[model samples]
Target chain A: EDKVVQSPLSLVVHEGDTVTLNCSYEVTNFRSLLWYKQEKKAPTFLFMLTSSGIEKKSGRLSSILDKKELSSILNITATQTGDSAIYLCAVEVLFGFGNEKLTFGTGTRLTIIP
Target chain B: EPEVTQTPSHQVTQMGQEVILRCVPISNHLYFYWYRQILGQKVEFLVSFYNNEISEKSEIFDDQFSVERPDGSNFTLKIRSTKLEDSAMYFCASSEAGGLAGMETQYFGPGTRLLVL
Candidate 1:
């Protein structure tokens, strides 16, 4: 079975602090790894990583994938209360017949304290 | 920006009742999918539709579940008979393509919260 595990299931950080969320996966025919932020309802896209050692960033948020280690990390710098949300990590795998499915992790619940 | 949209943000139905969840995927997109997330659980893929047919489906998608793209814009999932365990947040998503080498960015909808009593 394809599995994606995220570390530090829950975390609490103060405003202005930096935090790193971890995700590790064991999947066959791996195609891509994606990150999402879930606030109250649906999850919003964050970053998608395909190549190893390449970092994808947006403003204060950045993510990098390490294929050699079968792991990925999402870093948030200068965090604010608005950053509080459940961070989800999903791995996409090819299942033949030109089809793909996303296997997601349990997600990391991040709480930013003011 | 074009995003997927689902109807009946919340649906409450009795067990053994039938319900149809509707969705309108992003214009110009060719691929559509259905996913569900039970409370306090990970999101799970249910089915993937392309070219007006079902291209793939998970084991969770049984005979009781059916999907159809009846027209140019509307996609629907029909549950013949609901069960208590079927209560969940059903999400509709779409992408421009379906293969492994494509962009494969599946845009998701806000989801319909189904509660079976």
Candidate 2:
């Protein structure tokens, strides 16, 4: 079965600390890996990684994909209280000719302490 | 910035009743999808649509569910008969294209919370 697994289901860190969340997947027709941040509402797009070894960054957030390992990692630096949320990692799988659906991990809950 | 939009942020229905959830995807998007999350659970994919047809669907999307792009802008999901277990946060998402080479980002809307009694 196509599956996504995220480690350290929950974590608590003090403000300004750097955190790394992991996601591993095994799926057929692997397309791309994506990361999302979920607060009280729906998850918001963070980064999409396709090629391996190339890092995608947005301010304090960055992510990289390792196709050989079938995994990806999201790194958050200098975390703030506002950064506390559920970080979701998903893999896009193409089941048919041109259709894609994302299989998501259980999500890593990051709680930043003041 | 363009974003997907959903209506009736919250809905309540009795068991066995039908419910229709609506969404307006980004104007230029060619791929649309529906996903649901039961409280404290992972987001589960229900279906994906492209070229006005269902391209793929998950086992969770049984005969009880259907989707329609009734107009130029609206995409809807209908539940023939709601069950108490159907209560969840249904999210609507849209992407400009689908597949590995497209590099499309699926943007999600504020989900509609459905409560089945």
Candidate 3:
């Protein structure tokens, strides 16, 4: 079965501090990796990593995938109270030629204190 | 900027009662999915639908659960008999399937919180 694991299940940091969340996975057919931010209801997309050693970035947040290590890391720089939320990592797998599904990690809860 | 939309931001029902959650996926998307997250638990996939039929479903999607795209636009999930365990935040998502390989992103709805009491 495809599995995804995230480290540092919970983290607390003061405003303006930087934090990194980690995720690793094991899957039969690797397709892509996606990151999401969840505050209350549904999760919102953050970034999708398909190639190794490539970094994808958005304002105040960036993520890189290391295929060789079967892992990815999300970095939040100059964090603010608004950045406090659950970070989720999901691995998209193509079981066969066209079959696909996403296996998600438990997620890391981040709290930024002001 | 289109998004998936779900109805009944919150629903309260009793055990053994039937309930249906509705979703209106992105107007142009071809694939739809249903996921649920129990409080303090990771979100889980329940069912995936495409071309008006169910393409895949998880073990959690038993005989008590069913999905239908009854019309051209709305997608629905029906639970015949609700259990306490069925209480969770249910989300609906859509993606533009049949597109370039690995190029699609599944956009999610705000979700409907279901409470069974």
Which numbered prediction scores highest in lDDT against the true structure?
2
Model 3 TM-score is 0.96
All candidates: CA RMSD (Å) = 1.0, 0.9, 1.3
Error of 1 at B10 (Å): 0.2
Which is better, 1 or 2, measured by lDDT?
2
State in Å the error of residue B46, model 1: 0.7
Clashing pairs in 3: none
Once model 3 is optimally superposed onto the true structure by TM-score, how far is the C-alpha of residue B83 displaced, in angstroms?
Answer: 0.8
Candidate 3 on A16-47: residue-level lDDT in tens?
Answer: 99999999999988888999999987899999
Give the higher-TM-score candidate: 1 or 3. Answer: 1
lDDT by residue for model 2 over A1-114, one digit each (tens)? 899999889999999999999999999999999999999978999999989999999999999999999999999999999999999999998876777999999999999999
Classified by CAPRI criteria, candidate 3 counts as medium
DockQ of 1: 0.73
Clash counts for all predictions: 0, 0, 0
State the number of backbone clashes in model 1: 0
DockQ of all candidate complexes: 0.73, 0.78, 0.56
Task: Categorize the docking of model 2.
Answer: medium
Q: Candidate 1 deviates by what RMSD?
A: 1.0
